[model samples]
Target: MEALLILGGAVVFLCAWVWLAVTSRRLPVGLFVVALALPMLTLLLRRKGYSRPARLLLLTGILISAAGVALLYREQPEQFDQLISGSWVTQPSDSALSGTLMQQPFVPNDVRWQGKHLIFAEKAGERIRRSLVVKFDRAEALLQGTAIDLLPGDTGPWPELVLQWYTGALEQPGLRRLDGGYSMSLALAAQGPGQTEMVVHLHLPSEFGTRLTGVVVIDGQPQWLGKSAAVPEPRPAPEPAPAPEPSRTWQEVSILALLDEPQMYVGQAVRLTTTSGKEFAGTLTAVTDDKRVVLALPQGANQVDFQFHPVDIQRLQARPRQ
Candidate 1:
């Protein structure tokens, strides 16, 4: 009975291991092999009459197999859920299945490439410069582009890349076919005088019709390239500097002290408080020779001057124009 139980457990574990190894794209090969070997070791222990250790080994194998399956499901929960529900399986000969796949493509939710804009970026020091602007047409199965070599600090397009077919055809005006997501070469014109013509090679691979992955080679040096938004976002203009704070210091002086050199305070503003506790503020329009002060106050759209004599004024404070 013990042997039968051990054999059944081993068989179940093997079936699960095989299913996982086949279904999971991210299953570690070494770990899969180790997990498979554990069950076999358990079987060997059973044959050697180490019953208790064999049971523990069997249990450990079962746990490892369950953990691996759980990890695979967690990696892509929706995909596993569909697989468990048997919704992913479709008969290859069914014409209706093809239409269904096209109408509802199986794009992973985490994939940001599908239906999203793509551009090429080149890292220049701390700044990421836009190098190429291209869009993938999945239905057409081609990459269309307008490529340019932008200088470090230029707002306008710099020396552009002149693309030509491998057959030496001249580049067509406007957006053109750059690559078919396989292999292509771009013949770039010499950016400056006394320089030779340059060719840029690109190796872009289309994976699952969602991402554009590749390497760009310039002058025999290969660099990694990926899809990014090409247009640089408009940076907000820096906020205007706050106005300087005004001086809080004020000098209390007699009305005559201001009238002595009235030219200095002619266009200045004044805040006056009378002995009767009345207050007025306006532009110091004029100071009469009669020791009477004239203040121009705004009434509606016109300026009306108010005259104050030396007796009516109690406290006078003067400040220059801001």
Candidate 2:
């Protein structure tokens, strides 16, 4: 069904292009129409089992279309941008604000304006930093009110902007570094009066790609924001830590526990190395109450019993199960 729809759309597009080429008498449009139609015709021919001719036509069409599209995009960049790009305008409601938040790719999740307060939010996750742009219709009114608060996730009350502005410079009072990202806020109250247009730039915290769900509450009503909207900066790759060396010592209680399980350890191949650089490999025989261990060492057809103090042994490990 989808393929048929695509085919039908392509056919309509080609027919329109053909009509434009014929009526306007433009050489470029005619060439572009030919380029666009060739691939479709080649596909139809291939589907009909005309393999050899289809392949030849497909190759030729692809090359022509590629060159034409590239030239068209370069010559008329604005047209290409219009075709490929889009813009999102948030619908205004009693609980939400009425304004254009961002152009297509940088669109926010939600925006609201209540009285003199303007609030907008975008989605962000852990370790990622995304930018959000907020435009105020009445900047002068907001600048005369309270501070602008920027809160990332639940950790807030951060005062991003204070009640002072000097030569377009803002006085950030509660700007601090957070564990996941930066803790900051923004306030337009410091801006000079009579300013009609105001744009606020904000960088939300990173939460390791986990969506930081929060709201930008303005005036009193909470406006929900941040739903996979913010585009975060690429974090640097983490450095791997070095592996730790294994310990050689054993606890006294652990050694005693092994002795209690004589039935499991007895006749099993065991290896013990001492701090004095002596090593022994044999089958475990007996464990004495005096903190000593006995091993039956293989000696030709005979077995020799070896005894050693547990305190002197530095490392002991069991061999592979036989």
Candidate 3:
């Protein structure tokens, strides 16, 4: 009975050790070896008449394993909160944000643009603009319920830029915050000879005015980078020209006359205008009694046969050889 109790305790200790190792993503080699040897050690101690030591060893193993598992479980929530996974967008509104965050002070680096390495100007004075897209599982609900106040700011160059999390693994990049839906981050950076980088973070406030989630970090370069300090005002666009009225020649052309005399127009240059506003110019190749008109349209080095129904043609005019 004592041996069975010892074996059972060893089994429980082993299971707890495995769980802690897997949860923490690190295998404590010494603890694992001690766990595996506990049963053997207890058996040997009992056979040598050290029954008290056997009990003490079993109890020690159980307590240590339990403590490790408890510690890991206590930290599980914090580990979950620290995980950052989602689609992020960055500046001039076309770039995506990507990077890695190292723990033990949580320094973020390897900032990339759309998964590629970021390239900033080597010299100073380049004005850089950036943007980002953030996704949320409760995005619709959050937007609908909350009074989203996204005020843009950054650092490093202009000191007014900030940046954000998710689950089920966001596969594609997110769309830019449109209109008043969600606001995107915008910041201006003046490049220098040293490493020119910026980090953006996002914060959400709960309805009770408390902070929702932890900081979400987004990193990337600018989509539009210019050295000019003053942005030029965009000129007014020129007014578009009015479309000309469609030709009235189609009303005068008779389809029945052309069908009745297909051979007369065959091999002649013809222009066909469809009611749908499509025009085709080609040499009339053949006309079928079934009302199908074939035209040999000149391509670069060859001719392509274009077949259309006479019913579809709004105008079919034959032109003389030029």
Q: Estimate each model's TM-score.
A: 0.23, 0.22, 0.25
Candidate 1: which pairs clash?
none
The runs of at least 3 residues in candidate 1 whose Cα sits more than 4 Å from the true structure, single-residue gaps closed, are 1-244, 248-251
Q: Which stretches of candidate 2 lie over 4 Å from their true place?
A: 1-39, 42-110, 114-146, 149-182, 189-196, 199-322
Across 145-169, the per-residue lDDT of candidate 2 in tens digits comes to 2233322232323322111111111
- For TM-score, the strongest prediction is 3
RMSD of 1: 27.1
lDDT of 3 by residue, 63-151 (tens): 66555444433433222222221112212222233322111112222233332122211111121122222333223222221112232
Name the top lDDT candidate.
Answer: 1
lDDT of each: 0.41, 0.39, 0.39
Query: What's the lDDT for residue 34 in model 1?
Result: 45
lDDT of 1 by residue, 204-250 (tens): 23331222122222222111121234544444323324346554334
Q: Which candidate, 1 or 3, has the higher TM-score?
A: 3
Would you give me the overall lDDT of model 1? 0.41
